[model samples]
Target: MAGRLRCPNCAAPLRLAGRVLRCAGGHAFDVARQGYVALAPPRRRLAPGDSPEMVAARETFLAGGHYRAIAEAITEATPAELIPSAGGAPLALDLGAGTGYYLAALLDDRSGWQGIALDASRPALRRAVRAHPQIAAVACDVWQELPVQDACADLLLNAFAPRNGPEIARVLAPSGALVVVTPTQSHLREIVDALGLLDVDADKQGRLHAALAPRLQSERRRELEFTMTLDHEQLRALIAMGPSAHHLQPRQVAERLARLPQRMRVGASLLIETFRRSGAAGASA
Candidate 1:
């Protein structure tokens, strides 16, 4: 994984030596004991990704298999056949890969696939590194220039996270595919209404298409819709695991949860879409 990384400062190839990764130009980053690296630039103005509490909640909820259907859809939708065989092991870059749950499942389905789980949060990367032995986790801001070299990744994954269109285009191999999972307007509507959480923007899809224009062309799109009957604990974890956690206080969340039914049918709806580098002939399955 270190071999695949470049120095964010100099864009020089990095080599792992003991606990440090150093480039020929003398730039260095220390690898954490838990086996993840930080490549984000020293100064950042934006708030950090997910906090420890959020990551913990997410880990717990995902471990219970609440989102198994969505994870399965992503794994099945990935076009592993399109990846070039020239690379020793095809690399799958999981951008904003919190906890690496989806990437871990994909690696399990695709033999010989290696993963790089990139996130802006150290807490998320800590868990991501342990998700699979084949995964190498990196803590870096996706909004900035990625630490990855050009045209190296066979598959780039962005699931319910911010997208960096140009960075994604630059890192993906010509024949590679990009998989994104976004929530539709009706997704988790019941939960949102019940707790007064943030709403999914009505024009999110249109905005996404505009953002990717002329750089990535759509290859496939699938809508996964399901219902989960969640108990109080499940519901609480679900809320704590998402953006709502940032807005609502613990007392407010508890009050809302207490008013809701003990068991409720929650809608889980998401769009799993795939794209290819613009102007590249669609790879045959």
Candidate 2:
């Protein structure tokens, strides 16, 4: 809803007037025809986060529900009592919310909740807007100061996205929780070497928690692992949708995928951690 969005220029609450969102400070952001809006700082240019091709590949891959367990695990961890609400309506913020797949799943039965998909990519927002009726797509870099009302979000979800610990701590309400989903070392191990895909870092999660120690405390953790049967086509989408796509050429990727069997069992492993503000919450995040 417009009530949560603040102007990146003046930090004022945005009001929806017709198809435009304007703040009292006279800063206006136009809603795109695709049903989303850009809220990046007006003075700074955003480096296109994901290309249209990459976004398309990710959309196709997620639509197949290859990672449905990740979404389900997040929903299972957050009970009704754990989620905060604003005026009886829950608010969910998904960082690096590519296509808003996980957020859509979380809000499936919660009709009273609104989900905001924040990403730096315009291409991703195009599909994110249609992920759910209550989803509001905004284009903004997650590493910078989020353009949302302070302490307004009831829940924040970060799945395979960048984390801005300070900014995250600043935006979360006192009782709100932050759920982060990351891949374990075993994830994609079957095909990582064969396809030269990006390798998972086992200790990455450790560093993440340490970085947020000043403001957040991990409350719960879960490991969700499964094997998915993916054909060459599905495998290609998985490859093209992530960081490896940037390092590999189109021909190289196609050639590598061709070497795979008709169907390959790919391991899907993830570590989900739920965190809430710590005793140092008042410290400058």
Candidate 3:
């Protein structure tokens, strides 16, 4: 499947040779020893996505099975049999995939499916590479053109990450589907109110539709809501795993967390929307 990748520099097809990927245009990217590749263009102005501390917190929190319901919802929404694998096994690209928790679970049930976990954080990519044997990690900024060939992805997963609508449309095959998981307003409301965490945007769904309009059409939308019992430590990790960690200082967070109850009921509410290429038959669901 690496043959379907394009060089970030020149958009030429990349060939994997040993530990390096080289394009006919002479641009080369080296695969890390941990089995991931960094495909961001050189010298581009890019902000770091997630810090090591944030990545570690996410890895810990996800390992505890706190969000297994969300993962299951995504897996159920993506039907493996719908994808055709005659050319090769279907390739599932997880854009802004953090720890690859959801993608790993999705791939586990699909026998021949392969996964690519793309994120801007090196720390996150390190853990993503080890998520599963069939998974490959790539460090790239999702806002820019993805380092993937046109119409090469069978499934695209975006969970709590930036939405690069045009790039997504370019990478999805004709029969491909994109599964987006965004937090609803009530998601973690308790923590947001108590800790002053970032709130979900009021017009997120409208904005999402606008961003994806004219290229991809919504197929289905499902809401998954649940409650989690979290201790102080778990709560802290949860806070650190999201954008809230960037806004609040460590001291402020610690003081706030200390005042909370030993155990708290945290809300987990999200909207999982599936989209198909525009003009496809039975586009709406």
Query: What is candidate 1's local distance difference test score?
Result: 0.89
Poorest 10 consecutive residues of model 3 by lDDT? 79-88
User: Considering TM-score, where higher is better, how would the candidates rank from best to worst?
Assistant: 3, 1, 2
For each candidate in turn, the TM-score is: 0.96, 0.95, 0.97
Which scores better on TM-score, 2 or 3? 3
lDDT of 3 by residue, 15-52 (tens): 99999999999999999997888887889855488999
Instruction: Give candidate 1's total backbone clashes.
Output: 0
Candidate maximizing lDDT: 3
* Quality of model 3 by C-alpha lDDT: 0.89
Error of 3 at 26 (Å): 1.3
* Residue 38 local lDDT, model 3: 86
Candidate 3: stretches off by over 4 Å: none
Q: What is the lDDT of residue 181 in candidate 2?
A: 93
Over 93-132, each residue of candidate 2 has an lDDT whose tens digit, in order, gives 9999998999999999577789999998998998889989
**What is the per-residue lDDT of model 1 for residues 64-148, given as tens digits with 9 covering 90 to 100?**
9989998899988888576553367899999999999999999999887899999988899899989998999988889889999
lDDT of each: 0.89, 0.87, 0.89
